[model samples]
Target: MAMQDLDPSEFKTQAPDAHGQVSTLKELGDEMKAKLARLGLMIAEEAGAGTYLQRDQTTSLCSTRSKGVEVLPIRQALQRYDWLKDYSWVAVKADTDKFTRDAASAPPDVVQGYFVRGLKGQVERAPVQTCLYVESRSTKQVVHNIVIAEEGSEINIITGCLAHGGIGRAMHEGISEFYVKKGAKVTFTMIHEWQEQMEVRPRTAIVLDEGAAFINNYIALKPVGSIQSNPIAYLNGDNSRVMFQTILYGKGSSRMDLGSRAVLKGRNTSAEMVSRIITRDKADVVARGLIVGDAPGAKGHLECRGLLLSDTSRIDSIPELDAKNPDVNITHEAAVGKISPDEINYLMARGATEDEATSMIINGFLSFDLSELPPEIAKETKKLVDQTMKGL
Candidate 1:
């Protein structure tokens, strides 16, 4: 069956269990967790790495455990959510009622937000893993997240979104909004895992204040039928900065289009966007990006590159830039091509089989050196990258 274009702004509401009846957490046995663990790689050894949020059959959050962050259901956050009392560096709260009143005419189906404050140049981490399970065919799950960083504070957040089911189809729509206040910084990393028949689309909007910075990382290597999204960022304050990086792997008959855009609207602001895509099997992919410099001292760059592993697959890179001010600078480059056989032959001559050589070349293409990341995040990202070209 052919999949139609999906709107990331809307999705179906939560339903009852597979049998069409309401079920409690006590009914979701350990066996379900083990089954989901296979798809998410939530193993026993990494149990204490970060917070785990497992969604079996609803839009509500089902927290498994936490390390240094608080986990709450979206409904709970709407009414009763708070930050850690002992943690003096941050303040958090939420009000779903206000959100509903504000969007009274056309309210969102799933609205969730959290407030965060950084304590005077201190750094904190808020990592999350989200899993969605399907009991019915073509299940749609929509989620929205709002994050804020107070002045002079810093925070790093990593998120993993995954889905799995024995028999049924699933779809995910996620929207995220970020506000980086003056003199503050925020870094975000997102990874996705889904079944071969699933679909996913995530929308993102971000704004930076004076002297603020936002770094974003996105990766998706799992098999899914269709995925498409383009996030936007606005650098609206002086000396503000933004960086967007993406890595994607397309498999099966999947169709994936992903990209990000950055706007430099403030003096002395800068932006950078880089994307890498790998398409195999009968997959089709397009990498798109745009950068705009509107202020006198603004600067920006955008790069989009793709590698195809099969003659039957297709890939395209689209990079665009716009500059309004004579003193502003913005540029873009795009390229799409197959792997170089000469590089593979060199590895093959070095005592590696053809498959091993190909894997090495692919890994080299997708690898990103980040010595400043947290150990656990680095480890998990490496695991995903290593698994990208395996069992092809």
Candidate 2:
């Protein structure tokens, strides 16, 4: 169904036993844990600093293993800390869209989502893992997440979203807000694994303080009915920096519109937006990036690359740069093309079969540099990418 035809009120808001409690990921059934593992969750050992899980419209797990950070359900956090009101719904307005309105209008008792905070002067050694799973068919899961890194602190997070493999159809809407305080750093990696009939929409906004840094990595390599996401970051403090990297594989008849924006409002601040997309079958993909420099000494760049693997598939790369100040430096570049015959022929001449050469090229095309991610998360991300490439 088209987005305009979707009625957010038609889906059930509650599922039976969805609020059941679990102290650890191992408490979950083997089948469920295996599914989560494919989506980048560390289920075998407690290797992460924290873990949060939301099943359907309720929280099933929320725990933190480190004293430097705190992880709790959104509702509990809101009730425990009055200062949270200043940050909640501030980065992203609650009335911005219908999905946001749906999540905002939920009753207090049924509210679902996670709240994560990193204390001042502390650095978490492992990444915090979170998951939003849709277990009931035709269910609409709407959640709001907040993440904060206090001054001089550092943290890494890995989040995954997916639907049950057996589910015929479902919908997911998520709103996320992030705050990086002065001299703090935050690394966020998100992986999406959805069924063929799932529709996903995510709204996100981030703000940075003086000397703060934010690195974002996104990976989506599965069949889905449709997905539309555009996350924006604002560098409001002097010397703050932000970088966004996205990797996508679109197959079947899936439709995807993914983009990122950065507003450089502080002197000496910088931003980067990079994307790599591959499409096959009858898939339609649009990759977009924008950088706006509003400060005198601001610098920014935007890049997008696309590869078409099937004759019927389509890819559109749009890269834009806006310099509002005379002294600012901004640039952008975009390219969309298919595998070159010369490169394939050169590989074949090196004693590789045609099929083997093509596979090698495709694998290299989709590979990403995971050096920025935490060691454990980097390992999981590499495994996930290898598994996704096997189907191609």
Candidate 3:
């Protein structure tokens, strides 16, 4: 069906449960909207027309696992708000056949908002089953403006994008503007997986305010083509902090570009970035990190590591530290190589096949350090990563 034909009104919005319990989708969307509206009101009251001028740009695409799933076009949900006309962000998910053929033939509504529009409280979170296929073949773009309001308010968002069939190409561009008044927190998590022929490129920008905290985590495994992502965070408020972590694995002919960055502009601000990448077969992987301290008492740190399972596989690491303040503390570390021969030999002596040994070692490498996550999420993430590594 054409994107324009899929009416948002047709999708039933269920009422609250008997006890006034909010459904998953409604609760998420409403919470995001409330926060966004609060920030919009503040901007309108404080800066008047000038508040609208500071919006950011974003664009994105996804095409690896599109199959027999309902690919909801974001434009439908966005049209509900008039403020979106000034900025644009577009995303599409579908299977290979539908994406390459039907997607290309779909009406212009599917591809509209290429460069102009703004998005607010556009939140979607759901526990997608493994069978729902989504694909993005054509190039996609998005420009987004995100704002967060005052002390004690918080916004938490979670999303899982997966493909259970065929392969395709996808891209994403995102920008977030945060106005953290006094003390507030925003936590976001995005997880992705694709078939052997998919390619994905995702970019993000985040701005932080005083006494606020931001935590973002991205996990990508078993992509058939190439997966590249850039996550940037700007700490513009004193005593604010940001934490970012990325985990990725590539096999077959796949490649991955994964990294995170933070810029500290206020005193007592802090940032941390950690990453891990695994490459097998003839795959190539690159992990980059950067941390900048721009104000007195600001602090930053970064670490990245890559593991190569095959002699022909390749891995690269680029870590940077830029500091303008003498009192600031910043550090970084990078490593690129393979599993130790001794470790492999030890596993082989225990009667494990080379492949089995390699898989076990690789799983162990990615399993550690997830202790901080809630038990349920950590368990699910570990299981998913293990399943993805079996293909290697």
Which one is best on lDDT?
A: 2
lDDT of 3: 0.52
On TM-score, the leading prediction is 2
Question: What residue pairs are clashing in model 1?
Answer: none
Clashing residue pairs in candidate 2 are: none
1 against 3, candidate with superior TM-score: 1
Error of 2 at 279 (Å): 0.6
**Best first by lDDT, ranked:** 2, 1, 3
| Model 3, C-alpha of 218: deviation from truth (Å) | 1.3
Model 3 TM-score, all chains together: 0.63
TM-score of 1: 0.78
lDDT for each residue of candidate 1 in 1-392, tens digit (9 for 90 to 100): 33334442243445423233213333444755554443333531234322334353344333523333344444455455454222211111122222222222223334332333344555555334444444445556555555666777666666666665553456765556677889888777677766787676666678788999988888888778777777788889899998888888888888887888888899999988888888889988878888888898899888777888788898878788888888988888877888788988999899999888888877877887544455555676676677655755
Better of 1 and 3 by lDDT: 1
lDDT of 2 by residue, 1-392 (tens): 55445566777667535668787777887767887888779632477889999988778888888877888888899999999989999998999888778878877666678898999999986888899988887888888899999999888999989787787778888889999999999999999888888878788999999999999999999888888888989999999999998999999999888899999998999998888899999889888888999998999988888889999999988788888999999998888899889989999999899998988888888777677778888888888888888878
